[model samples]
Target chain A: MRNPLTEAFGIEYPIFAFSHCRDVVAAVTNAGGMGVLGALAFSPEELEQELTWIDEHVGGRPYGVDVVMPVKTLDRDAGIDDVSDIGAQLRSHISQDHWDYTDRILTEHGVDVAARDDGLEEGAGLGAGVLGWTAATGAPQIDIALSHDIALLASALGPPPKAAIDQAHEQGVKVAALIGRVEQAQRDVALGVDIIIAQGYEAGGHTGEVASMVLVPDVVDAVDVPVLAAGGIGGGRQMAAAMALGAAGVWTGSIWLTVAENGSSPVVTEKLLGATSTDTVRSRAYTGKPARQLRTAWTDAWEAPDSPGTLPMPLQFILNSYASQKMGATPPRELVGMPVGQIVSRMDQVRSTKQVVVDMVQEYVDVTERLTADLEG
Target chain B: MRNPLTEAFGIEYPIFAFSHCRDVVAAVTNAGGMGVLGALAFSPEELEQELTWIDEHVGGRPYGVDVVMPVKTLDRDAGIDDVSDIGAQLRSHISQDHWDYTDRILTEHGVDVAARDDGLEEGAGLGAGVLGWTAATGAPQIDIALSHDIALLASALGPPPKAAIDQAHEQGVKVAALIGRVEQAQRDVALGVDIIIAQGYEAGGHTGEVASMVLVPDVVDAVDVPVLAAGGIGGGRQMAAAMALGAAGVWTGSIWLTVAENGSSPVVTEKLLGATSTDTVRSRAYTGKPARQLRTAWTDAWEAPDSPGTLPMPLQFILNSYASQKMGATPPRELVGMPVGQIVSRMDQVRSTKQVVVDMVQEYVDVTERLTADLEG
Candidate 1:
């Protein structure tokens, strides 16, 4: 029960649940572990409102905010000029064939392409494809996040920039970076990150090549800081395995996406619940980054020979954001597949976030007991 | 074009070609990678003769012999008689209900019950019962192998005993152990192993719980010495991935069984070629240890609800050895399956070990070039 990670975070359990839903975040932190609201799906103004809601609902529980600032992106040098120039550059990169395929698939699935499109400019809708890493451009969002009492600032795609680390540390907030390899862990350590999240490829969203079983220990060994194991970890048995491999705590994302408080459309939750371990694939169809997502007709279409490959990073996200927003509202059966990992297979039913955390901890204790018996026997 | 692994071993590639047949061993060694003859199925004297034949044919090319010298076994405390007693114990453990189900299934498949009760023990006709990790008591066998000038000693289950490591080191031969986790790699290092073989669960034969993509880098980071990546490495792209993840070399086992020079029966080779990655499963039906093998009716029957759970270690192996030997000699379509890893899906053709090795190196080059180009671009 003495979790070093929870101690470090001033929480009850080391569990840090990453979810887009504010209710799930509040529920987890209130139960014990820290709840981290995923800010990737929200605009700066929207995220401020969500943080305000969490602050009101969490009742003084320490919580964190997660951002999608990546160290590398497609067209890293593409400067943010006036809005029109940025919008024009992004549009030029989207191929006609890719748009046609997206249109065809969404239309075939009974989604209204014209209504969703609305001749929007770049970075349209509730969630725009903003490159998380460019600190000068993203600094305002970070400033807005720091204005609230967010306990942790996390960069999902790579090590948070030195400025972000310094800014968070200056504000007395913990800085965390997600890494998939040992070299990245070493770099994060050198960059003075307070926490290293060893996110395996089995995790949802942009992940590196390593799996949790190997990556957790590799990161633990590579850095002196506490490591949180992420990816394909939904149960206590997996949490025990990660701890045994050297992780101080478990950082879970996909498991929360199916929780009762999760706002992921029932259609996406149904896909996650009904899926098996093999139903997920690491593809660049969503964000032009290798993200583990539910394997569906959309992914299959992207993989087809007739289709042009996915565009790079923010551009690809821009192309798909409209369909994702539409799907979220309309809940298409075939065209919608949410980002999730292989842990989706084990999610046979929905439960309260509190129950998920409690069951995982209980399972972890049982697994350790069994392993102890094996070793002693 | 220069393979550092091959250069280190002074062979064509870092490839340690493992085979049960002496002729194939000789051929692989003569072609470059050291042909390591699987000595588990051979008696000490028989193995001596097999090594003698390989020595004569290899023309002084450095070759080795592989023994199933598990660090622990079912009858570790018991001698040969104790092994037999364990077999009797296993028979008692199998309930009549399970036996009746197996009988019914075999009978339904037109397999005779009388044949099932045939005078042969439960295993491949090679011998009755499982091959116990006799390597501890297998001094004579080790002595025989040493007499033939083997350059390396490898144990799949655990570190070869300190004496074995010392003896091999004394003879200027390297000691290698297969590990499935980072902790195991550290253990092997502390035990003074010269080479650490990080075999992922995707590998055939006895394996630990971790998959290769995660296991390799963890082992590499855990140990001080060079680590050879094994499991699911059947081609250049995979080899490249392994090296990119920080492997010194790649160790291939399943791919060799499908090689042209490998003496695996045509029926077995055809089954292997036809099988895909999903066609393999990790089951303890063949050996007490979890091994990935071709999914067959025999394995299915053993895993069914009516069947008793597998016996522990060597005892389970003893019950199945007679059937395995029979299947090995003339692989029946319904009952035969070979110890193979996930890479079996890629083993779609029979090529010479030399050709395979050459192709892997070429592919490694192409893959590295691509990764470097992507980064640079």
Candidate 2:
């Protein structure tokens, strides 16, 4: 478990957990692996509350925060001065055809399209569509994260703005960026990123086309920073595979969604638990860019020939915000899906985050030992 | 190095090389790693000739032959009695719209589409479409292969038919099948497959949706047979990663294409050498099934909006057979691409097959030792 990353982060193991649930983040941090809280769905105030809770619960252990600052967004030049108004501004860009198609899909699925309220609170559990996706929204989250006792700050998409990287470095917080390509890794390294999380195609949320087995080592060979292998990595065998591919640590996202301490809706949790690796698809139906998520009727509707295509980043999520809320309120079993990697097949149990960490470490040790024995014999 | 696969195959290392070149196959076998020649492109007589050459070259070393016995093919029920006539019979099924679109694409690319002749010898270097794809074409190749001293017989597309499996077993030849899904692995094992090659999404040629990091372990857990990890594996580090993920050996394809002994055209070899991992795409342009190949003009033309969508298996290949020969003859640099994996980026040098095997073994040892040191400390 001892590596450059483990020593630098002062963690017992090199397992990095990414979760949107603050409880899961705190539990992983308390269990010796560093848990990173995803800040994409949270407002500045909500993020403050979550980080404060994590800081209090970790008992001085180090934890991190992950923010979504997409390099390219439809609202980047929309001239929306107020971050609160950005969501509304982006919603206006959604085409009427897209809306009509989306509604038709829900209607066909027997979902009540009119059930969603016009208030922000209705979209709470389904994720805030335009929140923290642009600089205007993400800057405040970064400011709040740096103000806290965070050990690392990760950007989920593209390289973090240089100014923000400098600000994080000034605050003694290490900056990490998730990249799916070797060119992106080089660009991130040039921008002074302290770590590179090479997320592969089999990962949840946004991912590149390359898989972890190839992407991890490619990024490792292309950059000088410690590379954390993300995507399709769930348990100890995968963790060992990442290490074998020249990764300093393993960055896992989907495995945390089904943990006992997490608060994922029962429907989504059950789907994830029952899914095989083939149950996921890399589609642009949810986000504007391709992301690996559980294949659902919702995704299928977007992929149908007659359906209107997805809109670009801030706009697509904005269009999805309402349907997401409706689905959250009364989940259609076939339409309720969350972001998950190919590793969903391995997450069959609802163990505590601490137990998951223990099992992964145990399995990693057993695999490495077996491999070592092969060399000796 | 000393896994069950190595002991069973009597190879010095657990490296399995897949190539269409007989020279590359024999060279790999002589280097102590078993080589499996792709039999999809050859007639029974050609395969016999190739196998006889390999037998004389390898000094009685163990090697294998790979045939494409697709469980479902367009000609499965075509009622074509003669294997030689199967190609022409299936070619008639190609629609006029597809032919015009193909010609338009070639013409747009400065290629003279009418230059392609109607002779069978013209399609020699480019893969023979409708050849060895169905049982009519493959059964004879299997017979020729069994007549030789082949150590193993592998099915590249589907599980070899039960009769073929029985015949191979009766001849004391072990059977292997390449699968992208865990369910496929289970099905192959039930049908008496001796070895399972869990080919991942990042692999060259036809592959499934799952990547090797996840698919290998999933298949390993589902089946009792030894598994060979394929896709996105080119070097020793990748070999180590496959081993860490519980694969008994490494099955490599794209790496062999760039080796000095391979007979790939200079244009394709140069393009492959210069390609990054992202330079390839899992496209259905060349083969109707999704296969990972270089992102070339040929693939792009087939994917264009105005282009008629590709046809199913044998028909699509048959449609491209003329264009393939033309491209091979004129050497359209952009259109002369071949099947390749994401690891094409790693094939920067033109090393001999023997050197490639030695380098892989050395790197595997180095990586395992480094991991062993991590455990020891």
Candidate 3:
């Protein structure tokens, strides 16, 4: 599809795939769609190494970098110079009562909260660097990302700061912000975002209650820039729906979670494949904000009446860091969960990212052709 | 626009406008889109009169009947012979404390519970013939509707009972059922439903949590029958989105609430027109199930912790019946509300139903052409 998205990003298809795994990124980029790597998961050094590997493997195709620099995140307005200052502030805010409650819930669920030594040894316990919640840390990541050749920069929660936007624009990297509400879309556009990813409530992580059908057209109407539709978009039909709602393209995340190159744990992959759409819930247990995820024992426990409430944003991430590492590495790994959209029900098997793109484009073409015939006749 | 929905219903556009008022149904049907009158709001005799008025005014255009024959309702399996029997059973189940709480909340909000004499005089209080909820009630409505010249019949909560389906089919009227989940789509298909209304969470009235972007494709894939996408479809962009998701047509409800031909009160229409997507909530306070409605004092009061919890289905309706009539017709009318989709945010003015249909078709044509050009390029 040769929409503005394809032309702006210089890709063959308008499908922009987001994944944490470099393998999926390289595969998608090489397959003619833009592959956006979730760079918040990697440190500066690790990100450099991963980018070098991708540059070597991608054959000079266009791809993007996704960073988590929420405008209203914890310590966002602290005017901090260093990531360490923000980390210290974040740690100080999480009460001991919340920590004790986490311990109680994890222990009750037979999760090995006691095996947190490995996390501390690996410096996983909250300190200078945690999940990319602070702009202080995210700015460095952006600097690292700009140090490389990338096509787009996508901010998940809100519009990236002026410095980040300007820096990306300097490198010819078009900037995008994902928004759940029309007001956010208007703000993002006014802030000079090149693209607005209008994600509906059905999306995987950090979603609002507005569904895509309503949210997409609202965002499209509110913004001057081209929009990319996200949330519950996995196939060609959904991509076409996005276009019908006046979006230039589709920004996909959950569909990549089970791709053969995604490199998620086999247990997690199997659970996702077997899960139905009803098996998911919007829970704040993981990220301290409402995110659609696989309903698991871990999420269910946090929702119970006896359990303590979750902390907000960075505090919740800080508290979750210690136990999250253990849960992934533990035996059985029953409580292991990740953010996924309602489209997980459709991801019944593992396929190459290339095949996924090919199938989607083909189906999108056929469906559109049929619709055109219906319209004309 | 010339899909199976058009062919099956003998309409020009594949847009099915649903409203309780005869004026809207007649106006929409005369304007080339099929207008399905919501028959649940009227008794058999009243519905006959409404249908006769529509038939006289609609310029020989086709229309349909929407009966709320939810397979499982409050008194579904009681083998109830009449609405009185069901209403009596429903009243018996509602505790006196609950009634007192309802009375207290309404009076405190300046709603006159004693001013419902007009409703009693007009036969608005529950008795022999109420809105469609049971086979006993819906069957008679179906019989009356079949005696007319409707082109389609639809059930809301579940598959129409075998008798209803058979009766509709016998008259060559196609049968449809609205579904919120993929499982419900399959069940409806198995019951030989001709069309499936795959409504998403953004829809007004009783809806499930699944949004249209996910639910539409899931339902379209699960069933072999033609699917009509509903929920948040107030304009052409959303209708285009539905078609892209493999829906044969678009079933709309909320957009009609503010139409010039709709008979809703000016206060409720003003609230709907001024509201945003966030102003509505899926609360059990209204229909004893999660129904999206305008968040007025009535719904807010029932949701408050100090307020008594809502009784299930018919009980809640029975309890609210007295106060709701007063709240609508009395002086203040502050607590007046109605079912509306998230697209209620976009319904900023009152337009004639003909303009709505004409605008939708034109927009649909322009969008499909743009998408086709994009795909071809």
Candidate 4:
């Protein structure tokens, strides 16, 4: 029961559940393993409210905050209030045909349209310009996290900037970065990252070029620090494999997205359940990064011949966010592709987050036992 | 150039260039990249003769022989020369319909028919059991190699058996094993394999479940021995990436398969030249192992609904060798899926093996210089 990773984090289990919902984070942390709230979708004030709620609900249990401080963002200086200017730039980047196609699709889906703001086509339903592109958006969110009882700060994108790392270290908070390459692992180590997450392309959400089964050891070798295997890791078998491959722990995301305590839309959960190993792709259509998502009709449309290729970072994200939300809210919802990985195939049923963590540990124990027995035999 | 790999082997270059042709082995060893003669198709006596000729031509530059020593052979104890017996067992394992379909396809393709040794089925060309299928087949070839000044014993399958490793070490020859997983690297270490070849599934021939980009570091982490990155590595950029990922060197197969020094069938060489990155598939149809080969009509046929699923290990290999041979001899080469990796896309034309190695090293230097400039800037 004494997970090395949990020991490292001073938590009950190595399970660091990544979630967008404050309720899920609070529930997971209270259940023992750390719940790391995803701060990419939230504004500074919204993140503050969520962190406060988690601080109250977590009952003094340790938790973490995840921010998207990608090393490469389209517009690093865009702020929330002044996003309209960059939003205008993004509008110019999008073509009229693309706009018409999006409108037609939303109308065909019977989505209730909000009245368009006349003065600015830039800051429409989506947030203003390049503000959504960079980690600056997460700066205030990081401040909110620092104010809470957060034990760790993880960057979902590239390594957190040197300043961010310094600030986190100053606060006595552990810093971790998700990476897909050995070079990135070395860079993270040089950047003084406490943990290197070698996430494979098989993982849900934004991912890099490598697969988890191969990336973990590469990262472990490139960095002296401990590595948590992410991507394609969902069950005990993968966890055992990761450990066998020299990972300190396994960091999973998709396995929790459809759990009983997950905040994922019901339609999205259903789609995830129906997906197989091949039912996902790395696309920048949803976010302006290579994210592994369920290969849905929406993803297919983005890949189709006629549609303009996806816009870069904030521009693409802004153009698609409202339509994505509407699609997430619909039935026969093949259009909306939720970020999931190859592990989606194993997410057959919904279970409580606590049960999921417990089962993973139990499964790990069983696998080791079986392997040992086989080796001895 | 003082290539470390060749120096390690007391050869010209570190490159252990794999080729089915004896002429290529002599040429590469003479030029630089130590040509490793593919002994799969050659009889023990023929292999000996080939090695003798290479020794005569390369002026003792340390050429080696490569044989298929698949771990999962048809019957582990089935003597390599017990062609009729093994063929009977292999045929029995496959259904009558499968055999009939195989026959029909071959006959349709204008393949010449010959009465099989057992006369159980009249199939096209010769029986398949004569080709390399087990360690038994490769053992004689190894013996032939040892009779020469061969410095390295490389296994195309899983880690060579303890006896093979011991035998090679006893002879002052290094034993190398190709691994696609971290656990396999550990297994190779426990088996006392002197070299761990972390070949990604993207590599040609029998590969495991991980890609090279991930496998190299994982292998490096799992073993103390020098690690070589195989799969998806063809040119200088990939070579740099492999070293960046902690590999001591690159073990390339596809790159050599197209070199002018390589005497690959003109048909096969052309296919490799024109192919793109997307033209390869990891299918078990060719060698009873998950090998990356050109996505050809033969591969399509093997995966079709009416076709029988491939048999396991040596049996599947026994059932397909004649077909492979016929494919090799044909024009426009239908049913001929040349074993290759994702790196095949980068192979645009045939060049001398030595020049290829030199270019790769030079390109690696250039790429590093560009990267360093970017870093400093």
In angstroms and one decimal each, the interface RMSD of every candidate reads 16.2, 1.1, 0.9, 14.8
* Model 4 agreement with the true structure over A1-377: per-residue lDDT tens digits: 45446776677656677888876787778777788888877777778888888888887888888887766655653432344355564456567776676666666666544434343343453552235345445567677777777888998667777887898889889988888777877888898999888887567888875555345645665688888888766666566556655566667778888877777777778888887655778888776677888887667777776767776676667657656544444534656678887677677898888788788767756655543332233
As for DockQ, the candidate ahead, 1 or 3, is 3
Per-residue CA lDDT of model 2 for B50-165, tens digit only, reads 99999999998899999988877777766665655655567677789988887777787888766765674434323544676766767888888889999999987888889889
The lDDT per prediction is 0.71, 0.86, 0.82, 0.68
Give fnat for candidate 4: 0.01
Model 3 stretches with alpha carbons more than 4 Å out: A76-82, A85-92, A95-97, A112-130, A325-328, A331-334, B77-82, B85-88, B100-104, B112-131, B134-136, B326-328, B331-334
| Of candidates 4 and 3, the better by TM-score | 3
Per-residue lDDT of B1-377 in model 1, one digit per residue for the tens?
23455565787566676778787777777776777877777767688789888878988789887766676664564443343344454455445654565456556666555644455443222252244354334555667777778887877777776887888888888877877767777888898888888987668877764566446655665688888888767766566545544566667788888887777777888899998655777898887678889899988988875676776666566546544433334445877788998677668888987788778767655544443332233
Between candidates 2 and 3, which one is better according to lDDT? Answer: 2
Off by over 4 Å in 4: A1-4, A77-84, A104-132, A325-328, B1-377
Better of 3 and 4 by lDDT: 3
Candidate 3 structure, TM-score to reference: 0.93
- DockQ, per model, reads 0.03, 0.79, 0.76, 0.04
Worst 10 residues of 3 chain B by lDDT: B121-130
Best by TM-score: 2
- Backbone collisions counted per model: 15, 0, 0, 4
Q: For candidate 4, what is the DockQ?
A: 0.04
